[model samples]
Target: MGRVPVGELSRYLLAGRLSTNGCLTSFRRTPRSRLVGPAPPTLRPLRTFHAAKEQPDPTHQQVQTPPTVPLRKKLKDEAKQARKQGKKKSNADSQTVEGWELTVGIEIHAQLNTPCKLFSSATTSFNDDPNSHVALFDVAMPGSQPIFQTGTLIPALRAALSLNCDIQPVSRFDRKHYFWWDQPSGYQITQYYQPFAKNGHITLLARDGIAPEDGKSVTIGIKQVQMEQDTAKTLAHNDNTQWLDFNRVGAPLIEIITEPELHHPRTAAVLVRKIQLLLSTVDACVSGMETGGLRADVNVSVRRTDDPSQTLGTRTEIKNLSTIKAVEDAIIAERDRQIRELDAGRQISSETRGWSIGSTETRRLRGKEGEVDYRYMPDPDIAPLVIGSDLIAHLKQSLPVTPDTELDKLISYFGLTPKDALSLINIDNGARVEYFYRVLYSVQDMIAADDLDGEGADVKTYAALVGNWTLHELGRLTSSKAGPHGTVDLTFAPDGDCAQVPDAELSQLLYHLYRKHITGKVAKELLMALYLGELEDGVRSAIDTHDLWFKEYSLEEYEALVDEVLEGEDKVLQEFATSAKFPQGKLMFLLGKMMRAGQTERIDPANAEKVIRTRIESLRPSAA
Candidate 1:
């Protein structure tokens, strides 16, 4: 077909009847109009006389010729009608694209907690010499074949099973090709088409100011969990040169992707923290983010639910956000950038962006790549992984109670609040958390015993005091020290090092305070002294040198001291009785005045308050 000029148009020629403006109309080109153009060479004049055979043809067949229309004019009329329809449809579907919505899906690649790499037996230690841990298969040397590590699979399976995901009976590996400085082979062995597990959910304890929870419960659905080999790390230089570290290459990695259910950056971080906790609980991964053991690729998107016709806006992936705070900032900044671009009537580009930690902004790195771009194929060297029912049963039986389940038990069994249970369950060390529970229960026992001994004490009050003090104050103190500064002071010792204080001793101290044997302030001072290893080591009996220190001060001796002080300062004593507010700057203050009067005898504040009250009573005039 020849190209049509812009000015040329098309007209349709119809053989059937046509309807226009509710009227059937038919027309033909007039002979006078035909004269306007040059007549065809075959044109002939009308014949006056005709042969009988030609004249009889009208009776045999009634010949009819339809008007012919130009092809260009027909095309123009069809296009005009199409354009009108298009305008009407656009008006009906129009929407305010002022704010762009981004749909984000993150694929986190975390290094598996294994002693060796996935395809090689080389040590997976991070700080070893470059290529020290690389094997023939890791570097993809010719004739060196890949082998799957059973050790790696165990931890990965444990992680998946703990997340309530099914352990597939058969899983396979594939080779994903991409060029990079660190990867000597230019390809990585990973799983793409088929993963080991799929469709799971993780419940996270949302942090304050992040979601609707405000440090409450939130659930994020997990889309998929896959096992793959990690890529080698590259250290870039200022001159654009790169140093390859093959130690990380071929290391087992488990990638967990979440559904785009998160609305805020902080919510995503909360999900990450919960996963980290669960991974730690299962002993599958460490909680350290700085060492590159764990990293996340955060996908972010936005949309307004009211508009149905509008297409979803572009999505950007925040690459390798290791720190929780950085992940949050990256999401905020990326969301704002997308909204601004839409507001300015510019389309948001779908791309992968890198987060600048120092500047705290996101910068475009590369456009998004389709699945086919990676040229993924089944890994030829390794055979298909086949898991048996027996192995699955054993794994299920061996798995510990998940953090969420344990958290619920903690709340119900120990009467802990939701917030406290969440904090306690997320601790890095499960053993420590268990020990804290033990101490809490032991303290309750002591409170009950004190009440039975005619020394009334509130269990709930003391339990709150112990729980808060241990979680906040004591935890802070222990964590601040670079080394062991003192022995562990607990209300009860659980059959271990003498470093831990016994519960009986703690109960004794509380009893003494209730009996007016020591002031609340003095009890803290003695506890600190005991924790500093000041008492005789391994002295399990409560009435040892430590108890002797509290018992030595007699009530009579303390009273006598107060009496002498009052007699020595009779003028001040009278003023204290008569004046509403006596000046104690020059005379008497708190226990400091008594301590100054008698340094040889260490008079604690508890004994002092009792002695002072006694003296004041003796000085008061008789009521009768």
Candidate 2:
């Protein structure tokens, strides 16, 4: 019998070994020394038998060879070798954490700011009547199928490209099976095996008291991003029954999954906010927590960095954190819970947990399940999405400057500190900062054209004043009514709401007050009146209003007010004449008193101060 090579032995054994009857079967290449008989005719061609008279017949030597080893022994040896190799490799690479390392990843679900749903023509507007927007596909009724919408895909692609992710030309969709009262279909149509975009990163801003500089910074790596349909919402009742609202069903949504890179819960929270801002800046999504436009599923796994071989600790999914602060709180609470469990020699289980806003703690709802539990399978109705590069490039070109780039530009253009620029840019409604720049540029153009002189007016100071008023006072007014951080969507028209106040008028008001053409009190009063809608219709300039409101007084009227003050306070005049410090102290006091009296009579306070100063100077020279 021929011996087989070790690699070919499995094939021979699988075909069955030689039969017990004297029949050759499953003939294999046998080891040369293991031949048990005279050389076969097949072997005769390869080697000729030579006459060996003195050393016995060579044929006898060939016949004396032992039979091949049994197949069972060979199989056993192979198994032992495999086991040995596995053990050696495991010993070298396996790491152990004192406690299990929790492997956490996040899945963020954000609603796209589209005019319609993913698969229907229903208007995607909020606050609609329940079930009014439902289409046959949204309800998953019989004979209804999904159709691709370019509006949905374009925005998602723009976001993916902005994040620097590789767009998958062909992406598959699958049905994710789960039970929820709101979902009439019993499963959501989502992308599973393949997704649209993958492998991107984002940098999150860290909170104060955590770490300064780069200590608390988090860089989250994305696993994939997919376009999907949002599930309907359930309105709950006290008796465990629920009311279904299909208004949100089939809303176009982008689901972004992150790798298990976040080491701390706070980091996860911070990372989510960064992504939210990115989405908002592109107009891809609104990311409003109050409006349910954004939601996150945070998975947390804990493992010691020191141990490489130990399995990671079980992770819990923190469900549906709406606000950034809530996200941070949820993460910290979960970390503390897991750490306490490990300290007590208790193991953390893989489960889904909810955050209690009142107590700020995680409450386990149910055990987490693997992907198979969803029974994901390709959706038979929809075909693979074929994305072209041209569309992607166009979208990229249309995108506005990114937040990071805008931050740097703001710092240089507005002469703002790094911290202030960052703070301003982080705001979701920060378009006002951009508006301020537009106005500043207009002012600069006016200065260059010689329409206004830049001598008495400092551009930097004026810019700061405008930024502070917009960011602080105006922001407060609008936010008080709309919500915090909100501002009126102003159009910088000449006479429209939120129109730009003219720089010349502002400068002129300041100049008059400084030169005593108008009192400081009168200038402020006039400015407030104009701000409160006192300006005439079709008014093109603030200077006209300032000149119209300026009050002129005769020297006799001013002198009378000054004399009244001096008569009532002879000690002040005496001090002005005798004391060296009286000019700055007592003499200024007399001037202020006279200004007050003049202001009551609609006279300019600046004139009163000037007249009083001149009179006191004349008296002082005589007294000396």
Candidate 3:
């Protein structure tokens, strides 16, 4: 009888070659091991919180009786049953608030925007044919070795720097073992004991779009920013059999772990959004949660709000929450569930859960996997990665400003209000932010060139106006729902609803407003025409072609227009007059009717508003 190594038994077992009779089954090279040496008694010490656990040898395993409930396949059957019979349909069991404080910590896995797999030359592509991008190492072929990718480090470091993390001088990879079809290697290579970077903090300020009114700062401590390879994705829930897609396998990933400081679900959501922006800003990762390029795992627990000790409760993790909305909803549901259970004198179990889109609640995935369950061990093949000071400095110097910094700069430098600043920076669809700056500078350049013609218009006022028009006029057209999704550099769109907002055309439109040539209403018309791809003739030409230039209306014309509006909307005018105080809303409503009755180009909004108020006051006294 030949001795079978306990550590290598899983490989043979998975291959259906291992028998209780105990004949040694082996390979020429055991999965990339350069030399196949005699098997040792054990791989290493497996640590447990309670005691050191012994590794089980397959030959000495005891056969136990089967359980009552049948498991055709552990993953498949459970998911099938769950989908067949939905859980917890009672709306009457609504979440009861027991004053239990919720604590949430999140682990975000963002796929780094790299050209190739982390340790293989296989190129990365989304929604590609299955196994199309796979390398020998990705499929865990025997004798295949991991070739360390230097390209991944640039983006990894960029991610770390964006989060204000301290880079570790040296870091090593570890193996997290789990026997699953998705991970054919049986062990995922990751950074565990020593990660790439750590001790980072992302401060969420009011301007960071988290707490706009609270005026308080929330600093989320990043425990670790580790570079890891993603596992192959498995599609099992909707189908009877498991389907493995290896395209995503061995893709570069950066796992960012945050300390459990977040209490509110909305803040947790904002934090995720902030991190998403940061990663994208630094060119580290493509932050598309819907596309599975980015995903989050929230570790949530509830504690007594009034408790003096402030001890954390037993936590259950909600895994792979794809959207920020899902992250918040899952945390809220989980916290509520725990509160309800505690109120009923039931213990909250620590486990891994999944978010059900249909039920809109957290469902149990499995028992919580502890550190011992993972059986982490350092990779023997890969050497420890060392980051030189020069490399760190080089990447640091090139790091772009994160979203929050850019937000502040827009407010302070461009004189944009926080509301307007947020609107510009957080446009989901296009490069409207860049479009804004381009138009701003173009108008400013025109002002600089023709100082006498632009006497009344200052650069700061132009900046404010530019921000306004970009958000309202420009952004209204080039929205996420409507595209010319701003794919090309300066050219946003060729011709569509969200056509290209060429700086020259937009700047000329603004210049007309600055030069007192057109009212805002007329300018908006021209802006819409630009959206219709009519700006090819130029803003100046369109204004000339349509006779859309501004004209001054006399006091009599304003009064006549006001009187015509009053006669048509007499009921609304009566409503305004009957109000105890001056109804500014009603006054504006009437003013809008008068302007739309046809004289937007001649009637300035400010003068028109003044005339309407005075006329309304006169009418009120006469009616009295």
Better of 1 and 3 by TM-score: 3
Clashes per candidate, residues 3 or more apart or on different chains = 16, 21, 0
Candidate achieving the largest TM-score: 3
Model 2 quality (TM-score):
0.64
Q: For residues 280-391, could you state the per-residue lDDT of candidate 2 as single tens digits?
A: 7787885556568999888876766567987767778989988877776676667767878877899889889998674546998988878988889998888888888887
Instruction: Give residue 441's error in model 3 in angstroms.
Output: 1.3
Report the lDDT tens digits of candidate 3 across residue range 1-624: 566677456434333233334433233224456455655332211112246665666798654533323223555788888976986534223222456677889999999989999999999867788888999999999999998899989999999988889999999999999988888799999999999899999988866555332247888999999988898877775658888899989999999999998877777888998788788677788556867789999999987878769879999999998887787678778988888888899998889999966456688999998999999999998999999999999988998766777887888888999888876765542256777877888888877887766564546778998888877765555455445643332234312122356677888999889767898778877876776776677989988888988887888999888878878676877776687777888887887887898566687888888888887787675643
Q: What are the lDDT scores of the predictions, listed in order? A: 0.65, 0.67, 0.78
- Regions of candidate 3 where Cα sits further than 4 Å from its true position: 1-98, 209-215, 235-239, 453-456, 478-499, 554-598, 607-624
Q: Tens-digit lDDT track for model 1 on 492-535? A: 22221224444445445555554545555566555555566565
**In candidate 1, residue 468 scores what lDDT?**
57
Distance (Å) between predicted and true CA of 604, model 3?
A: 1.8
